[model samples]
Target: MQQRTFEDFKFNKQILNAIEEAGYTIPTPIQQKAIPPILAGQDVMGIAQTGTGKTAAFVLPLLMNLKYAQGEDARALILSPTRELAMQIEENIRQFAKYTDLRAVVLYGGLGPKTQIAELEKGVDIIVASPGRFLDLYLAGNIVTKSLKVLVMDEADKMMDMGFISKLHRILEVVPRKRQNLLFSATMSELVHKISGDFLAFPTIVEVSEQATPAQTVTQTLYYVPNLKTKINLLQHLLKDDETLLRLIIFCKTKTVADNVFSFLERKYGAENIRVIHANKGQNTRINSINAFKEGTIRILVATDVAARGLDVSNVSHVINFDVPIVIEDYVHRIGRTGRASQTGDAITFCNPAEEYYIRKIEKLIRQQIPVLDIPGEVFIEKTGFEERQAIAREIDAQKRKDNPDFSGAFHEKKMANQRTNKPQHGGKRYIGKQKPVRKKR
Candidate 1:
């Protein structure tokens, strides 16, 4: 088959101009497969990983269908799992609709809704929102979904994981039943699949790549570190080479870890070079951090998984998984941040003993083992703490039990025996306890 170009899609002059300006000369695989069906008004279920140009696949067609601004109430609603993603979709819409007169607004939590409500009142063609904020505005009678022509659930899998199913159902109940639906996700989990059945009507399934697979452009490597401090040591050692480690993102499992990593990097690289973002950070702070990272002002962004999916900074030279994600699917998303736009990048994961279990799960999910690399001799290796060792042991034992219900691991037996040994002798202490209470009263 001959290669297809954006012009072959027969997009309007406005969309074509914007595409040209955005420097998109050719359609990605997902765009090639998904855009046609979506433009035909068919429900689409897009299964693709991050950084695969899935955003434009749907956005371009949605913009084409919208054509020009008609009514005040939003004609299309795009739901995202996180504020960052909602903002990203809105930005894409703005970029694609730049030549057109279409108006778009973004609604999400952790920020004031007053401005968003004002935008809705003024009238918008597209409303990109997180589930909770969307429902909140809908309940307040500020949003009228009767005119909604398109309903898109971007990152549906993540929405379900974030416990937005009930909210989704509520939104579905309110929106017109006949509108076109588009569902996109990195993975097709049982929950996402089930929810898609409810949301879409005979949707066209678009699978550009295997589910949970990282982008092929990324070179992945794994390092088995002993503990958290040692992970930091490795990070510092890698960052010392400013040329190869340019514009890095460090993914931590929790906000506390992200903050800790940020503090360490800030102290070493200076506050101007490093910024951290997580759920606890203020809305303005998070946005500023992301902007700074994208502008190349910040060399490193220490973030929790919140930034894993939605962030789209170009030319990220390296992505370091400071902590392995417990959700194995997120490994793909985290690494996907790098190696975007057909640019080669490195994804280096630092796995401690406990995280090794998660790494195994991630490897299995991705259907490929990450090539292990020996730690650099210059990086100081820290010994695992007693508590961390015990935690890892318990986790391993739990995994063993999960594999075989009847199998009792060493920890289980030791725990049970120790409990029995610590148990007070049945009746021996009762008389002494009563006598001691009486003496205290006297």
Candidate 2:
């Protein structure tokens, strides 16, 4: 088969011009397979990882179909799991629809919706939104979905994981039943499949590659860190190599850990060199941090999984998993941030003993074992402290108990034996009490 180009899609001059300006010459694998079906007005279920040009595959066709602005109400609605992803999709729509007269508005919950409502009233061709904010506006009578021609659930799997199923059902009830439905997800779980059945009508399924597999362009390595302090030590040691670790993203499991990592790196690299983003950060602060990272003003960003799905900065030299994600599927998305646009990048994971269970699950999900690398001799490996060690031990015992309810783990047995040894000496005190009673009677 001959290779196909974006020009072959025969998009309108406006879209073609924008594509050319964006420097997109050839269609990616997902684009190659999905764009044709999308252009044909077929319901499409796109299964592809992030950074695979899936955004362009759907956006280009949607723009071409809409052509120019028509009525005030939105013609299309794109739902995302996170505010960051929603904003990114809106940005893509704006770029692709630059030459056309289409207006797009982004709605998310972090900031006030007054400005978003104002923009919606002005008339928009597309509305990219997070589920909660979208439902909120729709309930407030600010958005009229009767005119919606296209309904897209970007990152459908993530939406389900974030507990948006009920919200999705509510939105589905309001939209036109005959509109085109496009569902895109990185992984196809039972939940995604079930949701697709509800939304799509005999959709064409497009799978560019195996599910949950990291892109081959990313070189992955793993380190067996003993504890949190050791992981921090390893991170500091690795960051000392300025050449290889130029543009980096460090992903922590939670906001607190992300903040701790950011503080440590900020102390070493200075506040100007690093930024942290999580749910606790204000909307303006998160936006500023992302912009700085994109502009190369900040070399490193410490973030939680909130940034995993939608962040698309180019030429990220390294994606360091400061903490392994408990949700195994997130491993693919976290690493997908790097090795984008056919550029080679590195994905390094730091795993402690407690995280090993998740690592095993991740390997199984991805169908590949991450190659473990020996810690460098020069890097100092901190010993696990008493509190952390006991915590880990207790966690292990709890897991064991979960597997076998009747089985008492070592921790439980030790506790029971200590209680028995500390029991009061009832026999030794009873004789003394009886003698005192007899003397009083006499």
Candidate 3:
């Protein structure tokens, strides 16, 4: 609990003013530990979870470095896993550099590349980017990376998880290896370690919090739902409760499931009351949905894991994990959406039998047992486990396919080929032979 005022950091007056304007009175732990090393032009590996002010940790020092080299070409490049996070980092930089003449631009996919290209042509001081679109523009000679002085890998763990290793490698090869490197992540996995090994030279390590640790303010609970349908009912019941009815973000595992949950909630509640956001939705739609949620115009926002990254909304009363995330770290981040800025909040995870493994992983990461609550009533209890239903559906589908003698010759041929070799399935769902329908279609 080391409390340091912004003035102590010796940030430029412009940046200090911007920080004051942004309402960040005190420096977060990561920021205090990281900014000095970064200012000294040292490679840094910062490990901190969401809501820990990791962005400012690098941004403040990077801005300080850029202030002297203002007229030079793009001196900094910050890579984020999602467009939203890229935009977020860039926004922070913009606010911090308002009085300074340093320019900043965000380059990402899902929007027109023309504006991004034009910005690159104009030569920005900082560029916050997602890996894919940035490389596309860079390789096309639309953006220059040869003079890159600082490279910040924001959410480095997620980049590796998203299979951006190759892209990162390619970008690294092109940029000046002698430049300052900063890597930040909520959790440090083996993959993240490997990636860091490649990108960072001898680096200053900063670990403000334990790996995958949830914020202390977040109150986590597990609701036992027997099936998916009942989980929905439980969610409705929970939301209707007076205390839980405030601004909420419901995390779904996939885009389809998010859409389905959104539609169901809208129909059950009111269309105007809830909004669905995911990668499948347009950029404007996602931004609008998030803004609406922040403004309280939309009480509920159902979103996939990717789209929910870097969301800065405050006062989110509850975060419902409608679907337990495949990746355990995601559970930490999802719940982190609430319980931010020292405010107490609730995170209710709806767990089905099949998803128990995911929940266990989450609990292991957070190093605590999530208190479980059984859904009230026999009907609700029986209908709670959505993961089990999904597993059953897959099993039924496999059985139907196996039993279908006339399903397809090619399918059987491929299946038999795999079976003959006795190759183990990668994901480890048992191969129950498909079932054929007895009724014939005329």
In order, candidate lDDTs are 0.90, 0.91, 0.83
Best by lDDT: 2
Q: In candidate 2, how many Å is residue 424 off?
A: 18
lDDT of 1 by residue, 1-442 (tens): 5339988888999999999999999899999999989999999999998999999999999999999998889999999999999889888988899999999999999988899899999998999999999999999999999999999999988888789999999999999998999999999999998899899999999998999889999999999998888988998899888878888999999988888888887787789888899999999999999999999988889999999989988899999999889888889999999999899999999988767778888988999999999999999998888888888788778877877898699756875785688753334432244354223545
Judged by whole-model lDDT over C-alpha atoms, candidate 3 comes out at 0.83
Model 3, range 34-150, lDDT digits (tens) per residue? Answer: 988898999999999898888988999888887853553688999999988888888888888887888898989999898888777776888899999989988888877777889
Q: What C-alpha lDDT, on a 0 to 100 scale, does residue 321 get in candidate 3? A: 92
| Candidate 2 residue-wise lDDT, 1-442, digit = tens | 6348887887999998999999888899999998888899999999998899989889999999999999999999999999999989988998999999998999999899999999999999899999899999999999999899999999998988899999999999999988999999999999998999999999999999999889989999999999999888889889989988889999999999998998888888899999999999999999999999999999999999999989999999999999999778899999999999999999999988878878888999999999999999988888899999988788777766767898698866875785588643434432344454224445
- Per-model TM-score, in order, reads 0.92, 0.92, 0.86
Candidate 2 C-alpha error for residue 169, in Å: 0.8
Q: Which stretches of candidate 1 lie over 4 Å from their true place?
A: 1-3, 401-409, 414-442
